[model samples]
Target: MSLVNRRRRPPAINIVPLVDVLTVLLFFFLVTMQFKQVSVLNITVPKIETAGKNEIKEQILIAVSAEGEFFYNDRPVDKEQLEGLVQLAGDTTPDMPVLLIADEDAPLKHVTLVMDLCRSHRLNKLRLQSR
Candidate 1:
């Protein structure tokens, strides 16, 4: 009998498992992804007796305290810079509403001044503070 040498063959490649795992990962990411962007501010507004729930689109909250202090979304701002700040905020979202939240004891002149500024800027949506 003649002696013969036996050679081992290499293993076959399998791509199906790899493709399945990749597809699963893709689906997981898509399902868990969020598409919305949210912006927020922290400020205390006065409560009003006649306050009603109103639908607010995009808003730049202007806060005024009883001490005649002015704030842009909880951040203190210089009274002289009110116009500039309002312009900047309006620029962020051109058509967004302006919400003015003044404390019950806040000076009326402050609120009126803010409203006048908004009107001058042609920002039509204006909401006033109450209660």
Candidate 2:
């Protein structure tokens, strides 16, 4: 009998398919992710025993900081600028709701001032947000 020697080849791993799958997963996550716009200021809203959710299609958001500073749509503004923004919003939408998101430590006077502004502008649909 003749002596015969055979060399066995190692199996090859294809990385192209793995890379394609990872890329697809990455894109899927990016496409389905929901990003929320967060404010820079630290705000802790007060909790209430009785609070209901009111969803309005079109509304303006006003944030009042603990220091009584005003922010319209996340941008800082003075009283005059706030008034102008409110007026513009009212002109665009007659009965658009105004949502007031005030910090828990904010003074009552600040809240009252915002309410007064809304009342003066005839923005009757006003809602206060709390935790």
Tell me each candidate's RMSD, in Å, in order: 7.2, 4.0
- For model 1, residues 1-131, the per-residue Cα lDDT tens digits are 33456565899989999999999999999999996523243334677688887667557778877788888776788777888987776666567788888877778898888888877776768898554
User: How does each model score on TM-score?
Assistant: 0.58, 0.74
Lowest-scoring 10 consecutive residues by lDDT in candidate 2? 1-10
**Candidate 1 clashing pairs?**
47-131, 48-131
Q: What is the lDDT of residue 29 in candidate 2?
A: 98
Put down candidate 2 lDDT per residue, 10-70, tens digits, no spaces: 9999999999999999999999999755668677889987998756756788989999999
| Whole-model lDDT, model 2 | 0.86
| Model 1 local distance difference test score | 0.76
